[model samples]
Target: MSLVARAKSLANRDALTRVGLALTAAWLLLVLLFWLLGPTGTTEPSGLGRLVRVMGLVLPLALIWVGVSLGRSIEILRAEAADLRQQLGRPLGQDSHGRDAARAPMPAPTARPAAPPHGQAPAPAAAAPSAVAARPRPGDQRQTAMRFEPGQAQAPIDVTTLIRALNFPDGPDDHEAIDALRQALRDPDLSRVLRSAQDVVTLLAGHDVYMDMLPPNPAPAAVWRRFAEGQRGSGVAALGGIHDREALETVAQMMRQDEIFRDTAHHFLRHFDGLLARLVPELDELQIAVLADSRSSRAFMLLGRVAGSFG
Candidate 1:
């Protein structure tokens, strides 16, 4: 409000430079006004009074500018916080107090059950259970809705489509891969493997371990057949044939250090193992070799080798 206070507020380097230039121009205009309105030879107000008057107007305008800038900054911060909350699924059924709206209590029934018939034992009232278990998430093998049994899935996903879907779509425009993935998702057994493979592949991608980049050492049909027949350790060591040292080291480190990646890799390994069991029984040696060349198969080899699934 006071002239000194207003000037002190605007006295920062950037603001002072702008105000100094504005004051210089204001001084000239005030002088010109005084000359036009002056009584000849009579006294006029001092320069300090004119300076205070001009500064009173400019200071309010400067405060408005600073206020607008701060307001914009606050709005941007609030918007970013909102986006972060949305990303974290913060509004997933909880209210402001953190109580789940979805789990709100229902009103009790007003009437009790009718009395049983005379001379007969009274029937017990049946209590309705409303707490249904949460459905298993995608890639969770605990679900039996899609899975029939290990090596016994009834859904007929072909070996080729199953392999292509496991690799996932090459790009959004790769309609063939997308179609194959869709078909695999429809199949009971292949869907489980594809979903699990997707998790492992994505995690591996974070470490720059791409299935396509890791060329596995060729394994013969007999090795795959032995693995399919439930052999483990040294008996199936040939299946762990990916020899890229860098990729192997990265995966081995993750298997030891990263819990999520380790679990996902194991899950993918199990599903792929089951898939091999189911399909190897139905395919010829040529089809088995082609299956080995698939990206899904490569990921299995990389993971199996690192996790010592094949010793």
Candidate 2:
């Protein structure tokens, strides 16, 4: 069945269940009252009284049966609702699914021309350009005909304007600032800058620039190295100074000391550091020393502070 129909059916079933529960509760209450108020002695024990007595003796049993039956019915309805949900591929809750379905895909409207004013003459269609007539047929090999539709010429992008808009260096290491930079770089007008930003972000992401701006866990270093290679091809300088061991060791040590770097260092160590070390062999020994020193220093400092406070 269609989703709407299934939904309506579920609603109807739920309503019926509520009504059934209310009626059952009322019936049970009435039976209990009748049992509490014994039959009047003045009137002959009416057939209704006899019936009530019999029911009073057996009503509890009947109620238990009713409860069991209702429980089973509820379970069945729940299972049915679940099945309907799976079939509809949506959760069973409020009108959320209905609202989502309504919003999912809009219907294509039929085109209707507007009526002209009472006395106005209809506008004439413009003549096709001479270029259209001079164009070779589709099968011709030499034709360089280009189709230019209305409003096809958009404004050209200005790279200098885009660069000015970037306004970088506002807290250079800020994640939000970097994201904005990346976004600005993506503009088609600044394709070159975008490529540069991509390289920079990739390289920076590999490094521990700031604590919160750490790269993805188990960093994709190989992918990053490949990206770096591509960027260097574009003549963008690779980050960091020399590729020598001492330079790398100093850089690593600086990164370890930077408070922000520690926050994301573990992720780098776990994922990308090994791959990066292999590619830039100078970093291998430096990374190990920096990591060990950073951890021990932090541990000792924390211990000393705690001991001083206690003393």
Candidate 3:
């Protein structure tokens, strides 16, 4: 069950308990008033006398029932809260995931060092064409400049560097990274690498890797087309059961490191962009609609916004 649903159920149970307690308290109050007034020494039985007698007999039993039910409800809520904490790896009240925490500002790229003064005869430019035909057209030169010879030096693909590059300037590109990671996770060829990773289990657990995080609302045909173009394995279907946020986050982290997912990463990145584009506006509209309603609407609106944003 979702955390919100569990919380709501607990709240309802507590409310029932409270109603029972309130009724008991009111009955006791009436009994106290009757005792002080002595049922107004009159002829027959008065309303106060009947009220006192009934309350004196029934209120204690009702209070006991309320106490027992309240205790049970508190226990259930406590257990649920503990489970939530364990799943999130921290206390619930501490903002364990800190989704609203402001992202650290990105530092600007440092400028390259200036070249030495020209008078010293600039050091020979690193590796250049030995000869340019005097009659060569500008277009020919441009083409030559862009050509890659077979023996030319090339940089190695440093995975760490690449992962870092994938990071956005201001914060982690969670949406983009998730898309790329999903593509990677779905690649059959990367299975061995993923299985071998030291953090694979935690990653999977955290992201609820086995759960389906797919948005439930109908998506544009273009979105499906984009997803289809890069899909590679049946593994994606395994995500249907996941309902935990931490598990989903862990899965995303794993995707970032899995080599199998690299080939289709770009497709996932694009899909992430598409998802954000679609969700943000819908959330804003829903928020506005919710704010126009009652105070209770705030809770529903917040939930809607969270679901929309995450999806």
lDDT for predicted candidate 2 compared with the true structure: 0.33
User: Could you tell me the C-alpha RMSD of candidate 2 in Å?
Assistant: 25.7
lDDT of 1 by residue, 15-128 (tens): 545654575577567767886896665567589977986786577556655765565555445544443343223222223233322222222323323211211112332321
Sorted by lDDT (best first), the order is 1, 3, 2
What is candidate 2's lDDT per residue for 1-311, written digit by digit as tens? Answer: 33555576567666666766676777778877876795747767889988987887677656755765676577555655554443333211113233211111112223223211111112422321110111111211110111111222345423222222222222223344344344444444333333322222222222322111111111122323443243323221222212234324433563456343333333333222232233333222222222212211122112212222112
Clashes of 3: 15
lDDT (C-alpha) at residue 249 in model 1: 92
State the lDDT at 181 in candidate 1.
71
| Stretch of 10 with least lDDT, candidate 1 | 139-148
Q: After superposition, how far is residue 143 of candidate 2 from its true place, in Å?
A: 42
Q: Which segments of model 1 are wrong by more than 4 Å? A: 1-155
- Compared with the true structure, the alpha-carbon lDDT of candidate 1 equals 0.58
Reference-based TM-score, model 1: 0.50
- Candidate 2: give the clashing pairs: none
lDDT of candidate 3 over 1-311, digit per residue (tens): 24654676677677767877777777778778877887566677789988987887786867678676877677676655554444434211112242222222222323222211210112334421221111111211110000111232234322322121122111122243333333333433232222222122212222333111221222233333333344323322221222345544444443455443322333333344343343223332222121112111111112222223223
How far residue 119's Cα lies from its native spot in candidate 1, in Å, is: 80
